[model samples]
Target chain A: MSNADHHLVAGAEGHQPSLAHHFSSHRQQYEAGKLGMWLFLLTEVLLFGGLFCAYAVFRANRPEIFIWAHQFLDKQLGALNTAVLITSSFTMALAVRCAQWDQRRLSAFFLTLTLVCACVFLGVKYVEYKHKWEEGLLWVRQFQPAEAAASLDESGTSDQQPRHAGIFFSIYFAMTGLHAVHVLAGMGAIGWVLVRTLRGHFNRQYFGPVDYVGLYWHLVDLIWIYLFPLFYLIH
Target chain B: MKPGPSSGTNLTHHNDQPFHAHVVPVIVLLAVFGALLGLTFLSLAATWIDLGTWNLWLAMGIATVKAALVALYFMHLRYDHSFYALVLAAALLFVLLFVCLTLLDTVEYYPDIHAIS
Candidate 1:
């Protein structure tokens, strides 16, 4: 192809330094990447969707089990984690915005804050999980709610513990365990982008990585939004 | 073409100038953050008053709102191309279909299972 034709093929708009050779322009590259990211996120939604369906099925079959079992979940800690995640999402959004504005330092700062929030979330999760372990509030095969049952009795709300209450813990561990894995993955991603931000790899011309990662992080937060109420706030 | 400076609007018309990245305002982000927190508290407070089955519905409804806010603004779905939104909607629709079908089957066969037990 002629030089002009090549320019047209490459992108009528001049070439961006960061633009991939195959893509025509920065916008095209960004749109393609974003569409791909959204598709990936769709699969994530469906993956979690299956678990949520299981939760519905079990809860519908035995609503009492959920009511009694949810009492074991510490609502205050769940609320605290929710707040922490929401704040992290806020900071992540700010990081994306700052990157879009080419504010490298500010973006890095926000990203650091997001990372810290993720750690806090995991720490709190550790505390909660440790408590569960101590009380043997685990999945069906490993469930040993003896101590938990005693506590419930002490509180004077023990009205014949629901049959197969371990099923609730099974679902809880399955759902939250998957979510915590995602949080760990999200931390790695944020850390990756944070390092890149420090290295000044991103500019307004190509902040797609930061933006996509932000989308993923927000999705992690979004899942928790539903999870928090379903698992901890069930009345 | 050179990427132009952001126009500093909540919803920048990406179609008009595809080169510029949409820079959402800090105020808008702060506002969304506040709304999300407010809804979180609202959902929590909902449990305090017994509304029978409505309590679950209320909590789920509030959580849905919070999820929407995160998806729309934090994830930039509002400022993004409609196709992205459509993709998400389609995924959600399929999820709904899957869950509903499964629940229907389970509920229909529940009596048979109970009889066998």
Candidate 2:
């Protein structure tokens, strides 16, 4: 090679600090970021996996409790939240697409829509949790059912005494509560991306942050897809 | 361990592009949304019918289909590198294993446990 080319490679080494010294190319850095995110997501799956295992074990031990207690959850509200999350996931996918196409305005719009949906989902959850609280259906130790629920037992519908039914609430609170935390975190991440997109930080050449956050948002929707049926559709 | 300095950089027109970064059509995304919402309604409706034990399985089956669609299309796992899909599958496999082993132990000890309770 020429002396000038060699000097170009050797000099100005600190020009782009964003590109780490270890990486040979932009593609490699992007791939490494994606791999790291996926590994983090894998750990997240295992975290929730343990909770799901607990849910299954408890449900197996006391089928009647789930059958009786799940009735307290409003299926319509759960279904509405399910639809809200799924729609938000779609918007998130579109936001990533717009960012890739370098359509900054569209990307910001879609991300805003997704953030709104996350808020709506949480609002519905608050309503559901409030109803449960009023009925005194709480976690194991603090659980105490209202008289209306006790009358169902008197009518021979479900022999599950109020206290015994706490298992379902335990699982419900643990799983959905954890999921709600993720939704809040997702909203924050989406808001961050939305601000950056509006400022034209991402475009066709550099949109990894938007894409990665879209994957995370979709995973949140994936978890809710399973949760709705499990908690609300128990016959 | 590094390659020689004389080695040519493997640059391509697509080098800057992320692997499998397809812009899914807006129609496709909406269609997926509609299908997910439809399935949610189906699961809700299924609860009204007295399917006995089959109810839970049916609901789970529907939910699984919806999850698969979201992962494959919305998350772009279908077009992305297969390694990421493998990672997800591995995580799910371990979850399945955990559930099955717990089920086996619980089923065996259930009666005795019930007697104590």
Top lDDT model? 1
Model 1 accuracy (lDDT, Cα)? 0.87
In terms of docking quality, model 2 is acceptable
Per-residue lDDT tens digits of candidate 1, residues B8-51? 23223344332345767899999999999899888888999999
Docking class of 1: acceptable
For residues A83-128, what per-residue lDDT tens digits would candidate 1 score against the true structure? 9999999999999988987889999999999999999999999999
lDDT of 2 by residue, B78-114 (tens): 7666777788999999989988998999999999988
Estimate the TM-score of every prediction.
Answer: 0.92, 0.88
The 10-residue segment with the lowest total lDDT in model 2 chain A: A5-14
DockQ of structure 2: 0.47
Clashing residue pairs in candidate 2 are none
- What is the C-alpha interface RMSD of model 2? 4.5
